[model samples]
Target: MMWRRRHIFDPFYELKRMEEWMNDLMGEMQTAGGLLLPESTGKEVAPISRVPSIDLIDKGDTLVLRADVPGVDKSDISVNMKDDMIEISAERKGEEEVKEEGYIRRERHYAKYYRAVPLPASVDKDAITAKFENGVLEVTMPKVAAEEVKKIEVK
Candidate 1:
């Protein structure tokens, strides 16, 4: 008879497998617009909350942040700055109606976005400026001047 190799059980093996499965499922769901749920009107719908992509750049005396918020109206976007943090939020609402030879289909979709960024340095909140153009929001914040350090000689 051939000798059989013994197998060892890992306590976290199942947990790791479950975590990987969950990650894959979440990825697929995000790409596929999430799981579809039946509506009261016998329609299948999926709710989506988009996380906007952002880029933060340090421009010496200023910090510039740019975020992509396509399909969102400028009026629906909000930017707030407090202390050393900045928050951005936006909402997009859309409705579509299609009429065929015998049936009409109507669909409505809503998506919201929110992001908060912490500044690496002190900023002049009162002088902050923001602009939205071409589905992109740009925020410029001026950095506060650093106080000069006086060197004292030790006796």
Candidate 2:
């Protein structure tokens, strides 16, 4: 009978397999153009710019959403509510700089972000209110009253 070799619980083998799987997934994503993240090379890929951090809270009678939008003017932000969805959009504009003597370096930052949040329960769109303070945007939406249950006779 020929000798047989069995290998089990090899840590490096599993790591290599995982690496191969991730490489395959990245290759497929690149081919389909679904992801615009930079590849292994230093070339820049463009698609989405940035995502503003947000926190959504669901209270018994209302839903609250807060977003971090530093360095953006309040007038540049827009909030809209439709059905059970709320969309928030904002743009940050860079200011023109005046160069002075012996200017070493200057950096300008600008970004546009948009996000849609779905509420767990129906909300009163017209009663929604929003406030912006200290670079944070807070939106409160009152939940709609639930329909009363009715008893039905069984046949």
Candidate 3:
């Protein structure tokens, strides 16, 4: 006679295995630049949006913000200002073609950037100015005058 050992099912063990698998999958997705899926044409597509690096500085009377937006034309950038927030968005499109002896290769690249920043103080939107030069965008916003608080005497 042959003896057989029965296996026991543990729900917790299954859950732990699922968690580990999920973590690994997420790590790979990030390394591959977000989730990629194949289209009907057999081409891989991924999300093309990114956040541009920026520097915000407060100079007492004004707030200066500098954002890096390389490979983007000035006409492709847009800046919107509200009482307490500023929004920046830009897009870049490029194409490259190469022809070697018997093969022709072409590639297209696209990039989109968006960022919204909240101001710590009220700004004078009418006096705000922006400049885009050498792939860098600089925005200067004047701070609104603060009202003086009057102290009351108590007996």
Candidate 4:
């Protein structure tokens, strides 16, 4: 006679899921303000010049890569294509001196940053255009036509 097996549903999975939820909730409360900040090494995070939190959208025949590069100078921003990625770099410096005293708390500091995003659609690198103003950098890379795409044959 062959032995029969029984399938048992594990109940601990629910407990694990609840554990994750509680951990996430606690982490958010810990970072609600500077009160939750970790000890710094006395070294500031070198701003990426212009690391744009971006939205890559497809608009017909073009891929619109919009990055949120606030407080970045238009002159300091640059867009370059590397292999299959688009790179944007910018640098911003804070005002040197504060005029009056009693400025107890000031946290709006600035630094340089660089951001790179991959283009989802095939883009016409030569036809791309970029605009920067109000501290926003927008780079438009036109999609390359299907007929324009080339594939390599592997040996």
lDDT of 4: 0.68
lDDT of 3 by residue, 82-133 (tens): 6699999899999999999999999999988777789888999999999999
How do the residues 1-155 of candidate 1 rate in per-residue lDDT, one tens digit apiece?
98544486665877999999999987787578754333332122345555677889999999999998988999999999977899988999999999999999999988877777888988998899999999999999999997899999999
* Model 4 TM-score, 2 decimals: 0.56
Among these predictions, the greatest lDDT belongs to 3
Against the true structure, what is every candidate's RMSD? Answer: 8.5, 6.7, 8.3, 10.5
Off by over 4 Å in 2: 1-48, 102-108, 149-155
- 2 or 4, greater by lDDT: 2
Q: Candidate 3: misplaced stretches above 4 Å?
A: 1-46, 149-155
The TM-scores, one per candidate, come to 0.66, 0.63, 0.67, 0.56
- Error of model 3, residue 7, in angstroms: 23
Q: Candidate 3's error at 152, in angstroms?
A: 9.0
Backbone clash tally (model 4): 10
Worst 10 residues of 2 by lDDT: 40-49
How many steric clashes between backbone atoms does each model show? 0, 0, 0, 10
Q: Highest TM-score, which number?
A: 3
What would the per-residue lDDT of candidate 2 be over residues 1-155, giving only the tens digit for each residue? 98545554778778999999999987787677563544532233334334567888988899999988777899999998877788888888785666888774556766776667777888888899999999999999999898889999999
Question: What lDDT score belongs to each candidate, Candidate 1 first?
Answer: 0.83, 0.78, 0.85, 0.68
User: What are the per-residue Cα lDDT tens digits for candidate 4 across 1-155?
Assistant: 98534465556866898999989886776555212322332223332222346778898988888776676678867789987899877767665545567665444556665666777767888899999877667788888877655789999
